[model samples]
Target: MAKGYWITFYRSISDPGALAAYAKLAGPAITANGGRFLARGTAAKAYEQGIAQRATVTEFDSLEQAIAAHESAAYQEALKALGSACERDVRIVEGLG
Candidate 1:
């Protein structure tokens, strides 16, 4: 099966509480759309080489499904809740097998 991944880049978080609120909604939205997180954490490498920021990777059964989740109303609402919280860079990549 082809898996899909969402690689996210974020700027230094100023409000962790807001992020937590976003995550609370985001987690369930993704699960409802058939996706799960692969990795989530601060950018540890920044300490050594000036990293871009934090990141979270979410995976789904297919790239189409991943994109669908991002466009879903529930996820869109979560994004709106997070929009003011942090700067973000996100992309969806297809996994090999």
Candidate 2:
């Protein structure tokens, strides 16, 4: 099966502390569910209208695993910690090959 990826874009961040807390929980949660970070942080440049202030990409062994990581209790805790501290978009996609 094709690999899966989680792509997240942060449009704005109103609370750094909340984001930090979310990251702390989310990182371990993702890893435990077979997800690995590929890229994270602000973009070097924006050449498109949809680009946000920050972007994150995580790879997973399969689409199911990617979705599972997002739904897992640990990640849910992270989301609760975040609690609208930022505006962001997240997408899960299957890799090309």
lDDT of each: 0.85, 0.93
RMSD of 1: 2.2
Window of ten residues with lowest summed lDDT in model 2? 43-52
> Per-residue lDDT tens digits of candidate 2, residues 1-96?
999999999989999999999999999999999999999999888886766488999999999899999999999999999998999989999998
Which ranges in model 2 have alpha carbons more than 4 Å from their true place? none
Provide TM-scores for the models. Answer: 0.84, 0.95
- TM accuracy, model 1: 0.84
Top of the candidates by TM-score? 2
- Looking at candidate 2, what is the lDDT of residue 29? 96
Scored against the true structure, residue 7 in model 2 reaches a CA lDDT of 96
Model 1, 11: alpha-carbon shift in Å? 1.7
Clashes of 1: 1
For model 1, the run of ten residues with the poorest summed lDDT:
43-52
Judge candidate 2 against the unseen true structure and give its global Cα lDDT, from 0 to 1: 0.93
